[model samples]
Target: MTSRNWLTTLAAAALFPMLAHAASEQQLPSEEGQLTVSTVADGLRNPWALAFLPGEQGMLVTERPGNLRVVNAEGKVGPPISGVPKVWAEGQGGLLDVVLSPDFKRDRTVYLSYAEEGEDGKAGTTVGRGQLSQDLARLENFNVIFRQAPKLSEGNHFGSRLVFDREGFLFIALGENNQRPTAQDLDKLQGKIVRILPDGQVPKDNPFFGKTDVRPEIWSFGHRNQQGAALNPWTGKLWTHEHGPRGGDEINIPEPGKNYGWPVATHGINYSMLPIPEAKGKHVDGMVDPHHVWEKSPGISGMAFYDNPRFKAWDHSLFIGALVPQELIRLQLDGDRIVHEERLLGELKARIRDVRVGPDGYVYVLTDAKDGALFKIGLSGG
Candidate 1:
């Protein structure tokens, strides 16, 4: 940790003595079974995402305030690892996601998404990668690979989540920078999902690869603010979810060259309870509808698919973190369609920010708060 962070931690420890200790284990009831919620670690400041390391290396976690740290198996949060690029650190603008390379064991490479400032004080979502040092104290030779275009000055809606497909292509989800009209702009990177090579090169087979006046990196467009993304192991397709204004938090399977209607046609009204001006109706002729939607927005965030069989009851279910409702949503899938929904973790009442299926087949979640926590969910008495 830097001197500043060290001092901050000390001050926080003084005010909250529990900051140095993990929360007691809690048993909660779920539809499938009694669930065990264990605090792997706490005192994380607005942690946004986490990626488990190979072997016994613990896990890498990113705090939204632009700090990255490792939490060991003993649930000890280490000092911040060095070499993270400077971030905007404003509202919803900071270090957001961390993911390991597909060939992480060989390359030891790690990827990150964050809010980066551009010219004229504007900011946009950016992606970068670096090799992890052997000591795990810093990143080596980190460099940015991709950046969202026309960096607007808006502070919200960075819409960044990184997912590497089975074929090795990287998919980056972007927000419209709270600029509603940009969602319909084909020439802009805002409100679009872009596919690129691991090293940040545009893929030749991308939908708009050779198109004139369109971003070659764009795989799909017309998104609002996608915060959760994952590759479906069963179909090898990318799945994502985004927040809606007043209602209509939605799940979508983003495909190449597809248009998902955002401001143009929505299942939601504006935050002021008025109809969206650009919307023609809830359904539009040229845009694809969401695969699943929630009438009452849950302020959805991270997403994961539980394919592991350790918890047979949760096997093959989709897990989504909810910020507004402070729950983890388990959506039962029947092939390509959602057949049922179960909400979990309401007893914790913390903003569930990120969800991941651990290597041990247990479910892991991160809470979004001033003093956030990392929780692991498993069968209580299995």
Candidate 2:
């Protein structure tokens, strides 16, 4: 089917609300019943992230090609919003995630992360904030809030995910920028989870704030390419997933000022199949180990915490999108640890790039493809 035609049909369906029921208690699907999957929108060019507005009116979606689209409840993909920065549009380096400010109702502020073009053919990830236009059609007052120091020449590893904490502070996930050594540098912001105020000021309480050797914005370091990060609703803890080269995708709970031991102590080897030194012990004294890990890579993307009542049975779980496995994984959490995992929609045959629990309490997924699709998955008892 044509991309436009598919979007038209899905938009029409979105006009009418669909009811969802709780799935059966068993981890596996019921023998006689099936979950319903419906396309809510299409024609997105590698949709990277999805965030719902205050009301159920619409949502803001990020296109990896440097476009921010407003998707209405009717599933219509509006025209690309302006004020997006010029990005390094190659090899996963383009416009990335978009997030609404915690005070969206009071101030219509929005945050965006992308691979900003740098001098002399260099490029690096940058985080920006701006106010959504009064009509919500475009962005205005756009300003760079934070930028990685010493831009790298490589086009890959821009872990540009944004998540706000309970204290209204923003945390940015930065990748190693294809330079493994940078991940261990305390002075550079690359390959680190940085904590900063909305205006790009470093937090005073940051672990290394006053330290002369470390950048004040660095919260934690030694990460490879962390793509997925979410705050647990129950515990308010930050959970992140970093992609390893050959295998060893990790799920970690980041602590202030702690080193994560990426290249120095990794379960995974290099892409060229070289061995990496393992952590001195199964669990290091100070470094955190992954609560759970994919010994085989699944190409993890965005993650979200499931707290809405629509899936009451699945409340307090972590939902992660997988690109290679092409599925949504629901991880049952028990006080900072993942107890169980359930794979959903592996049969869809699409690279699931982002998974979000919508304001309406349904699970929304963005597919990664030339003609990408937005899908809504709900429980429909057959």
TM-score for each candidate, following the candidate numbering: 0.93, 0.90
- lDDT score of model 1? 0.89
Which tens-of-lDDT digit does each residue in 1-382 have in candidate 1?
4566456445533543322333577899998779888898999999999998876678899999999999876788999999999999999999999999999999999999999998788799999999999889999999999999989846999999999999999999999999989988878899999999999999999989989899999999989999999999999999999998899889999989999999887899999999988888778998999999888999999999987645668767999999998999999988878998999999999999999987666788999999999998877644
lDDT of 2 by residue, 1-382 (tens): 4566456435533542432222221222522235567777889998899888765447899999889998876677899998877777888798898899999888899999998877777788999988888687888889998999878837889898899999998999989888887888998877899999989998899999899978999999989898998888888888888898788888888999888877676667767786764434334556666767788999999898887655446667888998988888888878776788888888777998889877555678899998998887766531
Number of clashing pairs, model 1?
Answer: 0
Error of 1 at 83 (Å): 0.5
Cα distance off (Å), candidate 1, residue 337: 1.1
Q: Give the worst 10-residue stretch by lDDT in candidate 1.
A: 12-21
Per lDDT, the best of the predicted structures is: 1
Q: What is the lDDT of residue 72 in candidate 1?
A: 78
Q: What is the C-alpha RMSD of each candidate to the true structure, in Å?
A: 8.3, 6.8
